[model samples]
Target: SQQGEEDPQALSIQEGENATMNCSYKTSINNLQWYRQNSGRGLVHLILIRSNEREKHSGRLRVTLDTSKKSSSLLITASRAADTASYFCATAERSDTGRRALTFGSGTRLQVQP
Candidate 1:
């Protein structure tokens, strides 16, 4: 698959600490998006940075993209117990016909202890 893969499948951190995850993809992509899934809850969009962009930030979330390395990183600052969730990186590929749906990575499960 042309999808990305996140390292350190799982992580544990104390509340108020920061959590960082890395993702690596195989093929070229049009855009990359980060999402968070809370237990049984649906995935929520965190940020979307195009291939042309280097880095972007939203609230306490910061994302960086390195197209040359085919990798990306996500950082959540001052995390809370509620911040515990599975984070995924998805790649949007260009299609000859139309825009294709995102291809998700294995994901990184984060646990924040209060």
Candidate 2:
């Protein structure tokens, strides 16, 4: 599997702080995406950075991709209690059938203290 692996399996921080998570993959990819899942709910798409891009930002979230190193990092600035969730990094790669396939990491569990 081309599934990525997230670092710092869990994190705890106070509200208004920043949370950062890293992900590393084994294969080449077309694009990488970050997703947030609140407890038992579905995953919410956060950001997507193409292989040709080095960095991208959305709201208070920043994502950086290093294609040479096959790694990516997600940074959430001014985090809040509502931002507590399991963050995952998904990589999109072209499959043998010429279709894009997504592989997700184990995820980083973040807890923001109120």
Candidate 3:
């Protein structure tokens, strides 16, 4: 499988603190995406950075890619209680099926203390 692996299977932080997560994949990829899942909600796309790009940011979220190292990191600044959720890094790769879909990692469950 081309799925990536995320470190820190779980994290707990105060409401106003920051949270960071890391991901590592085994093979070459076309793109990497960050997703957030809250409770029973479906995964929501947070950001997508192509393999050629190194970094991208959105609102309070920051993502960095290291293609050479086959790794990526996501950082959330001044996290809120609402930010409590699971973060997953998915990778898209070329496939013979003519289209590629993201392969999700195990995810990092983040808990924000109120």
Candidate 4:
């Protein structure tokens, strides 16, 4: 599969602590994005970092991309119980169809305990 692979498939952390997830891909990418999904809900966009960027932050999320390593990491700071969800990393690449396609990782399940 062209999709990236996420590390630490499951994580448990106390509320107010930080949670980190990693993803590694095999090909060059235009950009990488992080998303969060709650049970029975649709995915929510978290952050996006372009290949030219080393890091980007939004709210409590900090995303870092390393094109040299074809990898990326997402960090959620001061996590709350409400932050419990499955986080996924998706990479945008130019497909043979000449369109940008997104390949997603399996995802990391984060459980924030109160």
Which residue runs does candidate 2 get wrong by more than 4 Å? Answer: 95-98
Model 3, span 20-108: residue lDDT tens: 99999987888899999998999999999999999999999999999999999999999999999999999998566737877889999
- Residues 16-37 of candidate 1 have per-residue lDDT tens digits of 9999999999878888999999
Q: Estimate each model's TM-score.
A: 0.94, 0.93, 0.93, 0.93
Better of 3 and 4 by lDDT: 3
TM-score for candidate 1, residues paired by index? 0.94
In order, what lDDT does every prediction score? 0.92, 0.93, 0.92, 0.90
Off by over 4 Å in 1: 96-98
lDDT of 4 at 60: 91
lDDT of 1 at 102: 86
Listed per candidate, the RMSD to the true structure in angstroms reads 1.5, 1.8, 1.9, 1.8
User: Considering only N, C-alpha and C atoms within 3 Å, which residue pairs clash in candidate 3?
Assistant: none
lDDT of 2 by residue, 1-114 (tens): 246899889999999999999999988888999999999999999999998999999999999999999999999999999999999999998466647868999999999999
**Candidate 1 residue-wise lDDT at 81:** 93
Evaluation by lDDT, superior candidate among 1 and 2: 2
Q: How much is the lDDT of residue 61 in candidate 3?
A: 95
